[model samples]
Target: MIGRLNHVAIAVPDLNSAMAMYRETLGADVAEPFDQPEHGVTVVFITLPNTKIELIHPLGDDSPINNFLAKNPDGGIHHMCYEVGDIIAARDQLIANGARVLGNGEPKIGAHGKPVLFLHPKDFNGTLIELEQV
Candidate 1:
């Protein structure tokens, strides 16, 4: 089952501008940008008191963020990540409950370097959900 809210991911057209908004304007403690080639995104984490905000930009033309940005030029919230005690067990239970897992239905290393899986947006009331192992 899902645990605490891990982070909320937002796709941005310009990562630098987004970083400045969070760092300079909001005066938030933002981490340095990290390029996740495997995930096809360049990301930065804006640490909040209780959770984190992840600003992500497309890494390449084929990146999924590209399509997202194309659909909404201003960019917006892409997904919400929740923590899980056991990712494998959580995955099985979700699947048995008729929830569809994205991609190959296997866990992948997320931006936090933790095992993560994405569930279909339709299964979760139109919002994409990410389950990360705590």
Candidate 2:
């Protein structure tokens, strides 16, 4: 089952501008930009008291974020991540419940270096859901 809210991911067309808006304008603590070539994104986290905000930008033309940005030029919330005690168990539960997992239905290393899996957006009220193992 899902645990605490891990982070809310936002797709952004411009990483630098988004980072500045959170760091300078909002006076938030922003982490350094991390390039995730495997995920095809360059991401930065805006640390907060309770949870974190993830700013994601396309790393290449083939990046999924690029397609998202193309659909919404201003960008928008891409996904919401929730923590889980056991990723495999959670995945099985979701599958048993008829929830579809994205990709090959396997966990991948996320930005926090934790195992993560993405669920189909339609299965979760049109919002992409990411389950990360705590």
Q: How much does candidate 1 score in TM-score?
A: 0.97
Error of 1 at 117 (Å): 0.3
How displaced is residue 54 in candidate 2, in Å? 0.5
The digit string of per-residue lDDT tens for model 2 on 20-86 reads 8999999999999989999999999998999999999999778978878989999999999999999
Note the Cα lDDT for every prediction shown: 0.94, 0.94
Question: In model 1, how large is the Cα lDDT of residue 39?
Answer: 94
**Estimated TM-score for each candidate:** 0.97, 0.97
RMSD of 1: 0.8
Q: Model 1, 4-112: lDDT tens per residue? A: 9999999999888999899999999999998999999999999999999999999977897888899999999999999999999999999999999999999999998
